[model samples]
Target: MTGAVRLEPVDERNLEPLLSVAAAEAEPEDVMPPVDAPAGWSLARRDAFREFHRASFGGLAGPTRTAMYAVVSGGEVVGMVRMTRCDEPGVVETGMWLGRSARGRGLGAAALRELLHAAAAAGMHTVVADTTPDNAGALSVLRRCGAELREENGKIRARMCLDSAIPIR
Candidate 1:
């Protein structure tokens, strides 16, 4: 990570780079819907990956339900972050995944800060996330962003109030 981490709205222009980064840097299971095939980026998995982003990001018509962003670091797409509106008013559920190389360099935390700022600007009152207990990196980032964590049904749920958050610049 050479430059400041930033979130670029997912669209046709940058979507390919984001996908490329994902295919090269992160595991398929970690980033997209799991394919029941082998353990690598197969053609089916690649197509599925593209479709997943396009559908979730709400292609052409723009983000209808989820706001997805290409996580760029050092002027390159390294990962992705997204937030979807929840049933509760003024609340959103966020999820993010970074490439192996981008982890531990504070890019995840920085991208998360940007996501929180965006959520707050979008009038969201609270942000929530979930991860397995074994994912220490996600846990650390969530905690750093002021999320209160609790174990529920074999998963860790994190909740953070935007009112008290101070997003990193």
Candidate 2:
């Protein structure tokens, strides 16, 4: 059976391990911004990945504050989830990606549940996520999390209102 999944704060100590999982079990595009390197994870790409996480923590000084978490399961770092403050007050945008080896195992849903809880606890009134229509795995997780989904242009957007008094699922 798959182990229970949890979200731990992403920090210096665990960042390397998280990057290792991303390099070995996930495509760089799925986890980071587009890189000009070769198809595989290259040296420059790895450095960029580290910088991305580093910047995520610095969001507090900017207009948008972002919080990132390492997706942990079975005592291993398998993915990441993040919540970013949106331009709208009381609203936050969320995104997540799991290593290929960890996909389709209900882990994404579990991580999203934790992310939603975090959002509510952070005093967010709404949470939103956007993905392409072809990303079936993401769509499934959003639906399972009770998000209201709609397709606009070529993107599928999911939104959910937070109510801390009630449990998610």
- Best by TM-score, which number? 2
Give the count of colliding residue pairs in each prediction: 0, 0
TM-score of each: 0.90, 0.91
Candidate 2 regions with alpha-carbon error over 4 angstroms: 1-3, 59-64, 164-169
Candidate 1: 10-residue stretch with minimal lDDT: 56-65
How high is the CA lDDT of each candidate model? 0.84, 0.86
Model 2's number of clashes is: 0
Q: Give the TM-score of candidate 2.
A: 0.91
